[model samples]
Target: MDLLTARIDLDAIAHNTRVLKQRAGDARLMCVVKADAYNHGAQRVVPVMDASGADAFGVATLAEGASISELTAKPVAAWLWVPGQEIPPGVELGVPTLDHLSWLIDARVNAPLHIKVDTGMHRSGLRESDWEAAFRMAARAGLEVKGLMSHLAVADDPANPYTDAQADAFRRAVALARQVGLEVPVNHLANSPALLSRPDLAFDQVRAGVGLYGLEPIAGGGSDLRPAMSWVARVLAVKPLSVGEAVSYGLTWAAPDNGFVAVVTAGYADGVARSWQGCLDVAIGAHRYPQVGRVCMDQFIVWLGDNDAGVAIGDEAVIFGAGGVGATELADRVGTINYEIVCAPTGRTVRTYTGGTGA
Candidate 1:
């Protein structure tokens, strides 16, 4: 069996959901479970959401939305699209452009729809100039536009004015839609960062992704969100290393005279990034062990610091968890976002979930 494992704390997910719901206040919470709950395994996370009283869910594709729909009867919306795609029944679709809107209108898809407005993100969405025409056409075509939504370009930073500007633009788009006689049942513009930083923008619903997993969307900040996923592995060997002995691919790391090197059953293929070498450390029981040398494709070595560090071959090594070495710390070590760090592990790595009403 693969020694590498990812432990998901279902209770932590539920706690984060409750925290997010509180932050949302009067606005409904739409848990964004895209990318398999940021690689935390949505099959397990979505159920936790169902029990947590989430109003709905938002995903990147129809497949994700459909999968979530199977888990719960709550509303599920898919935002991404192909030129011609089949949106499953009872699933809401996000219209990216006016042309796409026309296609849905022509098809007479009676399913609920959320309109994406470009606002200031300049990414994907219907332009402000086309919102009136799109809304008018949708009304004429008898399409059900349930929500008006937009993405936050840079809300992670509490000081960034771009998010504020985007919020304003989104409001204007919604106003134009109303003026054109389109009934927008809900107006949503807050992602995780915006939801936490700007409670005022949590109009009708808040799309929270990373925050639900206990990883902060903002850098070096945000509320008390606990990380729900923990990457772990078993120590396969514990060997003595002389002060001058080199290790791994580049032989870049040398043992400190009294220290020993530990072999862990995980590497780049298991979602432990290669860049983690020399920087990241793992928790051996309650102690910390520093990773040495280059992380290999199948395994990596850790420095026990001393000969009697009390670690053994069968001991568990926590790469990151709610305690000890955490996801936020791991992300910083690799100069990447916490989202990418938590999502790094692969299917080859087994996932074991704990806590919540059900496993």
Candidate 2:
């Protein structure tokens, strides 16, 4: 085992996917595999995701789609963030926001795709009026409307009315498509949060991204999902510090009393963000350790106790895992999303994949 390595629980991936599969039912669960399966190693996780019952995979770029396509026989939908006049050859396309009909016409040789509707997210997808038009245009262009979908702008917010509104808009759009005689086979809308919290939105299919990894989007709670990634680094060096001695760069953290500071063998260069600052926490056995001072490019110090508890050099330090310390919580500490946290593992860390509980 390397000093710094990311332990990916392959079985947790399967478990989460099974939960998602149950929620999604016969509609098929589309596991969003963009950004290297949220940095859990798409190459490593796709096969397990396939075995866990993911009917299809969704990617942000054509390259990502191709990369995932090689791993599974299931259909790969390439979701394009930016519109181009032509679709890439040999890959199925997923348009983020269905804008123009001509774009689909230009990609005549590729497979069909699902349309992204900006129900209330205001990020992508076709407008309410354009929804029906886009579907008709896609069919006219010989593009099969594999799915009609929209995104929940605030599915994580239980009190937010936007989720309900998005659902209404999505249903309206689907009705309009059916009225126009378009074969809208699958109608999906909702991400991890929606899939977990708003089960009713699991229409014909639901895109499970973070939830498939067992992390709830909302801070407080949600459905049963197991986090599939665990980050661990070994304590490299331990040093005694006098009271009032500041640590790391910027002199941000000062020891109030005599204590020990242990330098961990990982840092921003390893994808542990410098912004983690005073926010992140690491663990040894059952004790919690605070990250002291500013996180450097390749190193960060943790405030071990003055009493030399049980942590020692070469002792494994768990950044997050099990009972609460998870990728989702790590992201929350720095005010980011779960996807960022999962993918934050620097390339330097050896990725060891295993199948079991407690990823």
Candidate 3:
């Protein structure tokens, strides 16, 4: 095992999915496995996901959809940010592609296709008037209208009124698609936050990404889902520091008093953000130590204050996950979001999957 490693709780993932399914109630879930399952290792985590009764899987790219098919041979549906020209392999393996009206005819695969509407999130999808044409083209191209979906820009913010408006727009698009003679079986427009905060947006299928990982995207974080990823690193060295001594770069942090400081083997290069300087804290055994300086490429120092002895070289310092610190907590401390925390981890770090309730 590497000194710095990410422990993936496979059982926690299964548990989280089951919890989300329950919360979603009547809504079918297309588990968003995009960004490599939010950096939890999509390929490695799919078995547990399958065992947990996932209705379907969603990814951001066709490559990811292909990866999903390769891993489980399960029905994988993907919403690509790019247009139709960038489609990848394995489209015949029951993976659905999503795009705007212009690219509707480009989805030449045998599987059903989805039409993405730009409801409010100005990122992807077709405009309102173009949606009907898009569905018409897809139907003519022999593509089954699996669903009509859109992304929410501010579903996590309860105060944001745009959520309802977006839901309404999605409904109108579905109505238009059905008018065009397409079987608009599923209509989805909810991400993790929307799924958690707005029950009304739970259409036929809800796409959840962050919630499955157990980090609340909504305000004042805490969700019904359990955390599935835990990052741990070893304390490589411990040094005695005087009150006036500064730590890391630019002298950003100074010891409060004479105490021991432990240098951890992981840093920004390992996904600990640079903004974590002097603000982040890690748990070693039962004690919490403050991050004392700017996170370096591969290392950071934690101020031990006046305590010592229990924490030594090789002692595990937990960054986030079950039986550990929360990513939401770290993101809040660093003035970022849970999504950044989930993606910040570098690929070099070793991952160990701890099988939970499922085999």
Q: What would the TM-scores of all predictions be? A: 0.96, 0.91, 0.90
- CA lDDT of each prediction against the hidden true structure: 0.87, 0.78, 0.77
Residue 87 lDDT in candidate 3: 53
Candidate 3 matches the true fold with a TM-score of 0.90
| TM-score computed on alpha carbons, candidate 1 | 0.96
Question: Which segments of model 3 are wrong by more than 4 Å?
Answer: 81-108, 357-359
Where model 1 places Cα greater than 4 Å from the true spot, the runs are: 220-222
Q: Model 3: how large is the Cα RMSD against the reference?
A: 2.8
RMSD of each: 1.5, 2.6, 2.8
Q: Per-residue lDDT of 170-260 in model 1, one digit per residue for the tens? A: 8898888888788797879999998888999999999998999998788776588888998888999998887889899888888768678
- Candidate 3 lDDT score relative to the true structure: 0.77
lDDT of 2 by residue, 1-359 (tens): 69888887888889889988887766678999888888788877888888878888888887787788888888888766455534544456666655444555664545677777778878767878777667777767767777777778778887898788888888888888878777778778978887767778888888889877767777686567778888888889888999999988899889989988888888889988887888778887677788889898778899986745767789788877753377777777789887788778885788888874333
Top TM-score model? 1
Better of 1 and 3 by TM-score: 1
Q: Mind giving the per-residue lDDT tens digits that candidate 3 earns over 79-104?
A: 65454455555442222233444354
